[model samples]
Target: MFTLSDMWTFFLAFFLTLPLVTLVHEAGHVLAARAFGAKIKFTLGAGKTLFKIGPLEVKRLYFMDGWCQYESLKYDKLWVHIFIYISGSLSNLAVILVINFLIYQGTLPVHIFFYQFVYFSVYFIFFSLFPFKTGEGQPSDGLAIYEVIKYGKKADPID
Candidate 1:
């Protein structure tokens, strides 16, 4: 069944959920990269650049796609790269944890939309961690980390 209200929900879900998820996830990458002394330049979304202020670039209002790209990343160390890649999903996991706490303490009211938001957030977290090989047979962050630990740099799927 389709209705105007359902359409609204869909829109709200995209608008509200995208920003929160993108911010937390991308911030994780940016922060970790900064810690590792990597130059940070990342897109909030792809398309035309809406504006740029210092290290941050705000792209098109499309808002569906975002990725972090570091300049002069240290490729010599496996562990540091692993930390940067894993931080995004870890931040999403942190959000799930905090939300659970808020629900437990009765700070945030439980509602359908909130549950949907949580589900969406969790979905993104797990999807990033899932390690399913892409069409190009590339391993995910979790799987890539495993390969690095067990097999060494030669096993990295991206390279």
Candidate 2:
């Protein structure tokens, strides 16, 4: 019963909601990092300046490269690095749980709640398994490699 138009609508809605899910997900890392005494630089978003309040940073090609860089700190310790690395995914999962709770309590429509849950769940799993890289011109892919090298060993491999 799904037509091309229907599929397009689904994709459009999914993309539109992605930023919100991403912001909440990234905010998780920002909060966690701050809790551990790391200073957040900025949390950038994709396309046409949604609303910025801090320093003006360079606009990278990949939208997902938008990040909250911390103050100068040593990346020598694996545990600390791992914590920072995993915080974003943790935050996303937290959002999923909150949304799920709302859905359970009948506060959100089933369609909207389900869409958010699935969207965040996919992003969380993907990012957790493969983080966004900063350099090499492949920010998203590179992050995943960095994360895998840094924290993947601490947990099970994605595959």
- lDDT of each structure? 0.73, 0.56
Query: What tens-digit string does per-residue lDDT give for candidate 1 at 48-156?
Result: 8899877788888746656666656555477877887789888888888888889889999887666766787787778777767655566666776777677774222
Stretches off by above 4 angstroms in model 1 are 73-76, 132-159
Cand. 1 Cα-lDDT: 0.73
Q: Which ten residues in a row have the lowest lDDT in candidate 1?
A: 150-159
Clashes of 1: 0
Roughly what TM-score does model 2 have, to 2 decimal places?
A: 0.63
RMSD (CA, Å), each prediction: 3.8, 6.7
